[model samples]
Target: MKVAVVKYNAGNIFSVVHALKRMGVEPLLTDSEVELRSADRVIFPGQGEASNAMNYLRERGLDRVIPSLTQPVLGICIGQQLMCRHSEEGDTDCLGIFDAEVKRFQPVKHEDKIPHMGWNSIQNCQIQNSKSSLFKGLDGEFVYFVHSFYVPVCKETAAVTNYIHPFSAAMQKDNFFATQFHPEKSGEVGQQILRNFLEL
Candidate 1:
């Protein structure tokens, strides 16, 4: 299968590349709209300022190409945030694949950290009914996460994780799937998630 990892001016691309290699797959990395759209599967990975990232996507016309992709696409971290309707991080408007908005973490208590980094277990939201392709063979597993903003619990949410309050850790809507956490860096369980995505 031809998997294309949409390369934008973002971080965490190498980690994802390595993860795919471990999964016995080597995905083409490109920002070209034609290349992205032609791939069998697409992985939209991002890590950086939202506005700049969206600007880059727009510059290459991939901002439109991405949303129109027919194959399964996975977004991670800032990639996931961009898939939402809007984000508070840069007061940015994003690709509306998921019908949710990204907001900065509002720590209700003094003990809560702002970024909400590290490992956390996911609470299956069961939005996808059967075990989702992304969560196949994994049940309520802990995965590595590092983010300051989060998508509010919404209709597309397939998995939930508690930070200050329960929020979307993973989401699915047709061919689009996303996770706020970095499954590539989450070790074994993370590998399984990536493998599951490859299978899908």
Candidate 2:
């Protein structure tokens, strides 16, 4: 299967590439509308300011092209945030591929930090369809996460994790799948997740 990584001005691109490489899949990294639309599966991965990232996608017309992809699309970290309807980071609007919005974490009483970083375990993993191509053999697994904003627990949530509160660790909607955590950094559990996504 051909995997394509949407390229843009953002961080964490290579990390995703390296992770996929370990699976013996060399993905094409590009911003071209034609290239993206024709790929078997497309993965959008990013880590950076939402506004700038959106701006870059808009400049190349990928902002619209991405949401219309028929093939399964996966978003990681900032990519997941951008796939949502909007983000609080820059008061920015996003692809709206998923029926969700990204919001900043509420301040805590000297306990919770703004950017959540490190390995967190997921509980109450609601993988409604056991046959889901993603999460194939992985269940109740932990993944690495790093973010200041989050998508709340909802119907689309496939997995839930609690750091400050129960939040969406991973979500799936039709042909779109997203993970707030960085599976590439989560070791074995992560590899399983990526492999599952690939099989999708």
After superposition, candidate 2 runs with Cα above 4 Å error? 127-132
Evaluated at residue 194, the lDDT of candidate 1 is 87
How far out, in Å, is residue 76 in model 2? 0.2
CA RMSD of all predictions: 1.1, 1.4
Clashing pairs in 1: none
How many residue pairs of model 2 clash at the backbone? 0
The TM-score obtained by model 2 is 0.95
lDDT of each: 0.89, 0.87
Candidate 2 — which pairs collide? none
Q: After superposition, how far is residue 113 of candidate 2 from its true place, in Å?
A: 1.6
Model 1 TM-score relative to the real fold? 0.97
Local distance difference test, candidate 2:
0.87
